[model samples]
Target chain A: TYTASALAFALRNLPVPVILVGSQRSSDRPSSDSVLNMKTSLAIFKEAPFGEVVVCMHGTISDDYVLAHRGVKVRKMHSSRRDAFQSINDAPLARVDFPGMRFKMLNPRFIARGRREDFQVVSKFSDRVVLLKFYPGMECGIIDFLVDRGYRAIVFEGTGLGHIRNACVDSVARATEEGVLTIVTTQTIFGRVNMNVYSTGRRLLKAGAIPGHDILSEVAYVKLSWMLGSYPGLDRKDYVELFHRNIAYEYNPIHKDSLFPVWSHEY
Target chain B: TYTASALAFALRNLPVPVILVGSQRSSDRPSSDSVLNMKTSLAIFKEAPFGEVVVCMHGTISDDYVLAHRGVKVRKMHSSRRDAFQSINDAPLARVDFPGMRFKMLNPRFIARGRREDFQVVSKFSDRVVLLKFYPGMECGIIDFLVDRGYRAIVFEGTGLGHIRNACVDSVARATEEGVLTIVTTQTIFGRVNMNVYSTGRRLLKAGAIPGHDILSEVAYVKLSWMLGSYPGLDRKDYVELFHRNIAYEYNPIHKDSLFPVWSHEY
Candidate 1:
């Protein structure tokens, strides 16, 4: 769900020098990303050391441009186009020209993971949950469908700290009656959901929706499904226990810098 | 956006107790939250002498219940009901209930903070963005439509580690051409997106789409919107810069927490 910060975030422990490549213009627009991406990719492959986190894209305002960037240091500035990529929090690793996609090193890099790890499917999805992404001026009773469908779980991405309009109280009630699991997540990108912070948020909490803490709706969905699968026979108390345990790396025991995967103590 | 956690997270700085209140059932249901929430809210409010971060929710299977939970140690188990709340890594501040509630607490809770200076809004969004939740067999070219509609940024909630079908390459190219900032976030809920870890992901990256580390798309959207709004004249480069800066506590900057917000972070 990281719209603009994905590249840098993903580059942390990459096996090789990761280069995020993008275009500010379209290939259909006669001045697209093909050349720039090609050039940047070549630049990183040629200029930067064999391994490190980097971003590769158009380096200059002209078409004959391309650049390689550090993955942790890159971001998207233009919403669309070949040259939209840039270095964030730092400068690029190298530059290149599409004319043979020549490389020019701007910085050096090193890889901690010598080779890429086999990306095993580590998702522990909680099954049978549906999400209701509540929006402004949204209609009420949309959640009723989940209960009708006999879903085991429902995650709501509410505005702010999981606050939904007061119009859907009945829908939530019905879902609870049907024994459907309901969780609340914030629509805002950052920040945790503390039910006691605001009256509106408190109301939603009072309505039976559990705070997803800082969990995103998408993550909640998978976790809910996983929980349902893991301990279907457990009573409410045991179920709660299973839900809270960090069987996977879903919730960090503490908000610390080491929470990242590469530097984490375990695989 | 973190209503309870923020207050609770900040309550670490306050000298008074912070309690998150909720109901196990909605008031609309025959089994509703009114009794539990009322009892719990009152209990925590009256017990404010011992400053702490407490989550107030239905304390028992009975409607007459409430528990003052410590935020750093609480967990929400059920998806939709009030009784699903519990203390995972820490003890609850205090348990309060009507005479008829099903259970009683056996321990006293610890206080975290009392002053209010620890909490504030720190979000920086990229306003020019939107999120496109993807499903298997989804329609192609929807990305192009958004670009045509002038959306500068988009997040694609891909199936696993940021993957999309090759059927929409043209739309992706078009999106890039329009200066549309694009990135891929996984739909698997937890875990980071490793593009080089997969051919499909690598293709998307080559097409100019960035991989969102472990951020959920919903969070990315709000952050992007906020960042975009904050910098009126920011071009793509400025957009990138602002996007990379950690604000609103949305991104797991150094390394993704391998999992997501679902797995409880034991305090």
Candidate 2:
């Protein structure tokens, strides 16, 4: 799922479903989910209405059904579970039942099937982008190391509400001063980052760090890499705008309280 | 909640329950949870059997009850929800029902109340500990920076299965060589890291990076900070043993699939 959204952004106008599939167990294992996963992917290719990048995987530990999640919003939540891939801060795009092979749209916010006259592919990607997860007492000079190394962008997986420690604010400012794209996403993984709530977050905002609202840190890194690689001459204002654009539905406008998966309290 | 576990480790022989409470909304807000949270905390102080640090917070969105989570195993999951704090990789230690003030132990594993003649508090902490969250294209020199800065320990929030990008393996080895404690925890946050399952993880293990089994990165950072400060001249083997020890229940040996807060697939 980490690279799937990047592929979608590069393809820009995907005309047919691009289903990325993987199995937790090896093919030699009888319990391997590969066959069912591939069948579901093929079923989606023949039946689904959306024409975009999606991750197809087991919906449950049992072979009951398979889920197709939006590529940009999914993440590997479990280390070894067959149903590891999950949609973060969003719902799975569709579900395909096991024996029946019935296709159903779980979320209606996906791009509809269509063809574009000017469909173009930009496969280029810059490897200079980095993701730094912020914690208390982190060394601020690490930011200086990346900026000094000619990195194009640095994405920070900040703490709750999108905050870096007060000590790292100056390093963020220096990154921005060096013309490196500085972005902040929450390390919480399940909520949007609102930098306006706390003083630490506010200081980071003042230092010109772009808050990546509901986007996962991995997705943010990929998006920024693609942007830098695709538009080498993109101006400062346009670059920030492009980073925040919902081109591939990467940014969910409003995360419904019910969207939180198993957090019982959200109810 | 970040500092609660550290405080518990410092005051290892806690005689009475230390209930940490905080509100999502300000006290001035009509919907603030401060009063109810404080009440639940006080209720736990008077009646709960456990004599350890625990976070007391709203268990649900309404005034149903408040939960007491083991301080070493809880995290602020949501940005602003009243029930933001969650017990990670473990169940809440107990619950304090609102109005009824009924107290119940949800998890049986807890330190029982007792008097200790040798009780001592080590309030000292080392600021030389740093946490680095690993990602693709990360600059390896950041590890060098922390090690050269006289940092005592480096905790890495690595990818799935506690693996860093292959490019970082050399730097990790160098840190271990310099007597810097190198620890790796999973970024997945919900599962124990099994380095034996993948080559990347195995390589990290071979590099002398201690796998922080199911320990949250923040907790690892705090525990290390406390360990380094309290025992300044500790030997190498002793430090690793202390880290792996469940001094304050900081390590949850097994993480059942159901412990995952809201990932629907676990069911």
Candidate 3:
């Protein structure tokens, strides 16, 4: 899902359906999902009207349908389940019934099929960016390592509404001082990251860490790479403004609550 | 929630319930959840059984009930919701009804009330451990920084099914060689991380990352600190074995499919 989303960001303004598909089980296995996933993806390619980057995979354990998830909003959830890839923080874009051979749109917001000539590819990506997941006893030296190495950006997968330990705030301040772009995304995986509610998060924001609103950490890394690679000369303010803007449907304005299609609603 | 869980692990074998409570809104606000949360927590303290470390918080948007979550299993999911703290990968230990003044044990697998004399405190903690989240372009130098600085452990919040980039495997190997314990937990936040399924994960395991089976990354860091501090002279094999064992019910043997209490049952 991260690779697909990164490709989507790199290949901007797609004019045709860019469906990324993969099978959880091997072809040698009797219960392999390869054939069904391939067939469903073919069906989507032939019939779907959207031209956005999307992932098509088994929608349920029973293999009755395939869900077309927006590349930026999808995640591989379960380890070895056939239906491992699921849309996160948002509903899937479409669904294709296997037995009925029918296609249906689940979420109407999508990039419609566009002209073939309008396609543009900004494929360059920066490898200097790093992602750090902050825990209680995380050392401040890791941030210093990246800053000293002249890295372009650092994305923090912070805990609970986007917070790093208070001890590391000065390190982040130093990173920003070195002109490194620091962004904070949540590790909760289901909720939007708001760096304004608590003193810890507020201190992080004050230290020049950009709050990654509703953006998945993986997608944020991909987007940051694209921004750094595509526009190398932009000022810090311009880069942050660009990073916060909704590009390729990465930011969801409203946070909708949805289950993983199997959990019971009992909290 | 992380602090509560760390305390729960450090203070072993509770004989009486230890209830931790907090409010989302300030007391000055009319919509503050403080009073209700406090009253419900007192109710649990005065009447409830099951001697364990638990977090008491509002169960839903309404002020009807408060949930008692196992301290080690809970996480602060939302930024400011009254019911922000939730039990991840497990059910709440019990629920306290506000209107009826009734207490119900939602999950009976709790540490029952024991003799008060059996309680023990092992609160020593080391701050040398770090939690690094792996992304596509993460620099390997960060691991080297920790290992060179004589850090004791590295808990990696890896991608789906517990994987770091292929390039960083050698760095992890070096960390393990230096007697720096390396552990891998999932960023998925909902599923058990399996290093046996994918080649990247297999390589990470071979590089000496102990698979953090069904343990939240935050809890993993806390447990590692406790191990390092409480039992100082243990060798690498002893530490790995101790880390894998379920201490203070941190590891959930079964992954329950429970929603966040409010989401609709739709994928």
Q: Which stretches of candidate 2 lie over 4 Å from their true place?
A: A116-118, A263-267, B263-267
Question: What would the per-residue lDDT of candidate 1 be over residues B17-39, giving only the tens digit for each residue?
Answer: 55566554556777677755766
Q: Residues B19-131, candidate 3: write the lDDT tens digits.
A: 89888788788998888888888878877777788999887767878898899888776655666777877888888888776878788677777777888899888887777
CA-RMSD of model 2 = 2.4
Q: How well is each residue in B1-267 modelled by candidate 2, as lDDT tens digits?
A: 567987788886767888889898899999999999999898899888888899999988789899998898898877767777888888888888889999888887888875776467887888989888787766788788778889979988887788888888898889989999999998888787888888888888888899999899899999899889988899889999999999889887766667865554321
> What ranking of all candidate models by DockQ puts the best one first?
2, 3, 1
Which digits, one per residue and each the tens of the lDDT, describe model 2 over residues A38-114? 99899999988888899999988889899998999998877777887888888888889998999888887888876
lDDT of 1 at A44: 64
* B118: Cα error in model 3, Å: 0.9
Angstrom error of the Cα, residue A153, model 3: value is 1.0
**Each prediction's DockQ?**
0.02, 0.47, 0.42
Candidate that would win on lDDT? 2
Tens-place lDDT digits, model 1, residues A26-102: 45677566655755575566455545545566654456657665443343432233444544223355666667666
TM-score for each of the candidates: 0.38, 0.95, 0.93
Weakest 10 consecutive residues of candidate 3 chain B by summed lDDT: B258-267
TM-score of chain A of each: 0.51, 0.96, 0.96
Model 3 chain B TM at: 0.95
Off by over 4 Å in 1: A1-267, B1-21, B27-79, B83-128, B252-267
